[model samples]
Target: MRTPNASRAALTLAALFLATLSLAALPAGVQARSSDRGKPMLINADDADHALDESQPTVLSGNVVITQGTLDIRSARADVTTRNNEPTRVVLTGSPARLKQEMDDGSPFSANASRIVYDLTSDTVTLTGNVTVNQRGNTMNGPRVVYNMKTGRVQASGTGTGSGNGRVSMRIEPKNPTPADESGND
Candidate 1:
């Protein structure tokens, strides 16, 4: 059972997830509308010494790097699940797995976490263990975070294990006029 607001939120999240994959490109000052959904996915690894089972997850270890369009991900190891020759999910693990992408607003976005799980089917990204996300000058830190690329929504939780002592921290910079905007052209 779900409440009205909860159902609405869920629908929005689902839509956002889908949009993250299907969007092409949008103007600046806006959230990223373009996605790597249809782009070619390339993976590079120092060592790929394991058998790949189509029905099972494929694990890549030793400096794994994945790239598609403007999205780049790096980790010490990754487990990729594929469906019909396409990747449906990826679980990345490292001292701090890193992910970077260009937002629709022309800002750079980055994140680091010990474990990152990206689910293509649900279009959601979950980060756990010392998760940190940065967009332009803004920063967020927490023990766990779930990000919706399409809606730019982020949900974070503290590091506490029900002790209620942990806390999530965030820093958001205010938007201000640049030097050029402050001074008119002569």
Candidate 2:
């Protein structure tokens, strides 16, 4: 025998899951609006490899692409490390990486960098070495960027590249600056 409240809760949960699946099937822009409910998936090419350490078993080299909601990350070489079959970390390197995600307001963001590191347990991702992110026509040029997968939080910092004078540039779309504005002419 089930109480009325308990039965109602079960039905609500079921409805939520079904709705999630339905939304995930939509295009990327649609997914952005309903991104609160979606699953992260990974795809790997034949060249990808995984190594748990030198002495342990290792998968050879290949292309690996990881997708989460509206976010997509592609890399040439990837190594997946796991303990007890639970993925602890993933490293993507060699061919560099491109990360694309749709912003909440329907704008798109793209990040290009040398390497991308993801920690499953911590839900954190770090992009290193000449990392540049372009979003909503604004560009963030930094050596590194750390983003929390679950919380949508990002921190940008230099990867030991010191000049103290970091550069940040933002550009609004449909509007183009004149030659003098670009060249800093008098």
Tens digits of per-residue lDDT for model 1, 1-186: 333332232223223333332221223445542665456556677765333345566666899776666677778987766665556676779999877767665677677878877777877778788877777577777787777765767677885434455568887666673555445664
The TM-scores, one per candidate, come to 0.64, 0.53
For candidate 1, the per-residue lDDT at 93 reads: 92
Q: Which residue ranges in model 1 land beyond 4 Å of their true spot?
A: 1-42, 49-53, 68-70, 104-106, 148-153, 160-165, 177-186
Per-residue CA lDDT of model 2 for 1-186, tens digit only, reads: 323332232222222222222211232444343562365343445652334343342332555554556656566765555565444565667446766666567766566768766666787777677776665565666777677756756677754545454543334444455555666767
Candidate 1: C-alpha lDDT: 0.62
Q: Which one is best on lDDT?
A: 1
Candidate 1, pairs of clashing residues: 32-104
* Candidate 2: Cα lDDT at 183: 66
How much lDDT does each candidate structure score? 0.62, 0.52
| Model 2 Cα shift for residue 62 (angstroms) | 3.2
